[model samples]
Target: MELKWTDTLDIAIELDEAHPDVDPQYIRFTDLHRWVTELEGFNDDPERSNEKILEAIQMTWIEEKD
Candidate 1:
């Protein structure tokens, strides 16, 4: 499962991601998920199936307040 942008998997952006206050918006979301997958090494193991990923995502029933 290589991470990449596909026409079916992406949405149109109304505005260009350009900001000076913090890291550029392009860097923020561009290949954003790719980095997460790489860091988690989710693609390295063939035994760990999608069901494992689903199990990993515990439904966040609790909310945090500031």
Candidate 2:
């Protein structure tokens, strides 16, 4: 699936699957941004993301972890 900044859940799942050992709650936004952009099928503008969007993605990722 092609991912965008709005695809928070999918992105979260991808991240969770890719980095199962890492805790989403403790991740830095900078690292998150880089990881999101690096994800396969991620086809959105990297510059489109901001703190709020990243927070949403992180929150979703946390939920996915549980």
User: What TM-score goes with each of the models?
Assistant: 0.21, 0.98
- TM-score, candidate number 2: 0.98
lDDT of 2 by residue, 2-60 (tens): 99999999999999999999999999999999999999999999999999999999999
- Summarize candidate 1's per-residue lDDT along 1-66 as a digit string, tens digits: 342222112111101112123222223333333333343213344333353232222111011000
**Candidate 2 stretches greater than 4 Å from native:** none
Reference-based TM-score, model 1: 0.21
lDDT of candidates 1 onward, in order = 0.25, 0.97
Local lDDT at 7 for model 2: 94
lDDT score, candidate 1: 0.25
